[model samples]
Target: MNLEDSTALQFDTPYMVIDFNQSLKNMKKVQSFADQHGKTLRPHSKTHKIPLFSKRQISLGAVGVCVQKVSEAEVMFDGGVEDILISNEVVTGIKTDRIADLASRGCRIKVAVDSEVGMSSLNESAREVGKEIDVIIDVDLGMDRCGILPDDFPGFLKKSSGYSNLTVYGIMAYDGNVADESRSERSRKVASEVETLTKLCKDYERINGEPQTVSVGATSTYDLWAEYDIITELQPGTYVYYDRRTTEYGASTMDEIAMGVVGTVMSKTHSNHAVIDAGYKSTSIDNGRYPILIMPSGDTAPVTSMSEEHTVCSDANQLKIGDRVLLLPSHACTTTDQWDKAAIFGLNEKPGTIEIKGRGMRE
Candidate 1:
């Protein structure tokens, strides 16, 4: 894909645009931090599922990649990521079987679980394959998303202990509350969360009788957790494409933002609002009520309103017909899911595009 002379060639009304230079910088920063802290850098691939980005991450000394779904793990494995960890629980029979198959095929795979059902699924699949599947218990520090409480963890582990084909790897606790914008509050939350996981690690070591590998923290709180020496691996997905929210967390600035949506001005409305072709379908608005827009000069334009097919930005008079604009989405993961491919930009040329291999993983 030679994009050197592609020259303003519009494909669709809206598409994902990536800055290769900024992305490389972001990757280097995260990798360097992980190395400095002696933590394994296992970036989450769900942010930018492009194969080229994964290769670059591995080249930057990333031990492996982290994903949430089985299909995502499969895609990354096929893309030359030899080691993978599904940071979330995999309960479905088919998904676990697929994971087992991947493990049999020589991909170093590890999955998380917070329930007996999830463990049984993986154990059964591993039994069928006659192999041992690495496992981690996901703990709920505060985010009521998918992990189990710290107290219920023992039972969850005990139930799966009898399986000879299952190796209890460690615990994965993601404290999303640490991503709070308030610096003092975020620091306190990260400290407490790491402390809690540290206690759990000691307790598990006492009861289960072995050293545990704890994989916790996001890109926002990784710096704090890295200081504690409790977390063994860092799974910060959004660092690859820093979003507006992550920027608020002080992980990266607007210039460090590597992902953007290239959109065209479609309509001129009120004096305060200008509409763009990219909407909910083109750029995901799932993070909150609004999205972040970027201009030609690299300034962000606030999203005043959004619909399925249109997004209204502030300062309508500033935009003209057919004027191209860029947008730094609110949530990089959700926004990247909106595109099938990303235009990878170079230092002095049009952007080269790469396929988002691990998308829409639901069966």
Candidate 2:
């Protein structure tokens, strides 16, 4: 349905809405950036979490998709994606077995391992399933998250060599901390991290032969890392649905934001404030800010506060009961995880629903 159609309000408020045309533009724009730089595009499926959109990304030139968990990988594989990378560590036995099961079922699945225990667990699980699993070594480049220390990476690789059921595919690093910095600052930080990554890859080659893939880069560093020949792949998920964070970080513009929360003004009792149906439960507050309100009249307002079911807007006095307002989340990835389905609309096609196949796949 046309966005302007009154019938569009039939759907309940606090629902995720995507501009299909803008999403297509976003997909192609990032894909083109990857293509121009001769880097493989493996857009992370965690942002959209929908198989349809992942397939669309593949159609546009993504080599495959990246997922953080085994369940998310299973959802994507079941949805017809052949090649998948679990970009995070899978430590639990059940999760590892699930990955092995997916591999045995003919899915080309690869997972990241940062510790010997993780690698051993995955190897044992794969052995139980009678299948070999490809793995990428996750090197910690200052994030201090889920990766082996750069200096200790060589030892980890050496230890991984003993796992017969695991095939070491390559190396992966995530620079999530640098995503919010200025472009130049982000580039500098990424370059410094890449130096460490490059050294680790070289050390890996010295110990384990040529590493097949040197995967790195998130949405914030996609363009920055694309200029480096060492990085073989780019794993950006948020670029598909640019949010206020991306726009503020200079990675994208407000006009390029494709996803929004459609919330209706529920109360306007105060002159300078109003309440919207969407709140911390509907949109994420991980960025320490509330979602921005895109008024129908092309104006904007800052969400002052959020409760479980209500978002207080600072300048929503123009809104009345039943007036719809679009909310651009501060962080798209977490906001997306809050939804079960997304209402998709395009310039030529009517609105439709796409299930968030990988929603709540935190396991």
Q: Which candidate is the best by TM-score?
A: 2
Best by lDDT: 2
> How would you encode candidate 1's per-residue C-alpha lDDT over 1-363 as one tens digit per residue?
112222144556587777778788889998998999899888888888866688789899988888888888888888888888888888889888999999999999999888788888899999999889889888999888888787787776676577788888788888776586577777888878877887788777866765467887787887777887767888888998788888876778867877777788888756767889988887777767466676655456778888888888886556776877776678888888877777666734655677787767654
Overall local distance difference test of candidate 1: 0.79
Assess each prediction's global lDDT (C-alpha) against the native.
Answer: 0.79, 0.87
Score every model by TM-score: 0.92, 0.96
Q: lDDT per residue, candidate 2, 37-142, as tens digits? A: 9999999999999898999999999999999888899899999998999999888888888998999999999999988888889999999989999999988898
Can you give the lDDT of residue 363 in candidate 2? 85
Model 1 lDDT at residue 113: 83
